[model samples]
Target: MRRLIFWTTVVSGIAAAYLLYKKGVPPGTIASEVIANPVGTLIHEL
Candidate 1:
C-alpha cells in the first residue's frame, strides 16, 4: 500500500516532468520540480 503510493507518486512526478519538457519548460525549472515533488508528496502523505 505505502509502496504503491510511493511508486505512483514517483512515476507521476516523472511523467509530469516529461510533459513539461515536451511543452518546452526549461530544464532547470523541471529539474527542481522533479526533485521537489516526491519529497513534497511524501511529506504530505505523512
Candidate 2:
C-alpha cells in the first residue's frame, strides 16, 4: 500500500509538470518556483 501510494504521487507530480510545460511554462521557471516555494507553487497551479 505504501509503495502504491508513493508511485501514484510520483506519477501525478510528473503529469502536473508536463501539463504545466504544455501550457508554455518554462522548465527552469517551474523548477525554481517549486524549489523556492513548493506550497505556493502548488496553490498557484491548482
Candidate 3:
C-alpha cells in the first residue's frame, strides 16, 4: 500500500543518515575523497 511504501522510505532514510553520522562522515565527502584517492577510499569502505 502507499502508506507502507512511504513509511519504509522514511525509516530507511533515517537509518542511512544515522549510519553516516556514526561513521564520522558528512554527506558528499565520499565523492570528493574518491576523486583524490580512489583506491584508498574504496578500501576504507570495506
lDDT for each candidate structure: 0.72, 0.67, 0.58
Q: Model 2: which ten-residue window has the lowest total lDDT?
A: 34-43
Which prediction has the highest lDDT against the true structure?
A: 1
Per-residue accuracy of model 2 over 1-46 as CA lDDT, tens digit each: 9998767656556655765677899999777765665555555677
TM-score of each: 0.68, 0.59, 0.56
Model 1 Cα lDDT, one tens digit per residue, 1-46? 9999888888877777777788798999878877878545334333
TM-score, predicted candidate 3 vs. hidden true structure: 0.56
Native-to-model Cα distance after best TM-score fit, residue 38 in candidate 3, in Å: 24
Clashing pairs in 1: none
Ranking according to lDDT, highest score first: 1, 2, 3
| Clashes, model 3 | 0
Candidate 2: misplaced stretches above 4 Å?
32-46
- Error (Å) of candidate 3 at residue 34 is 18
Which of the two candidates, 1 or 3, achieves a greater lDDT against the reference? 1
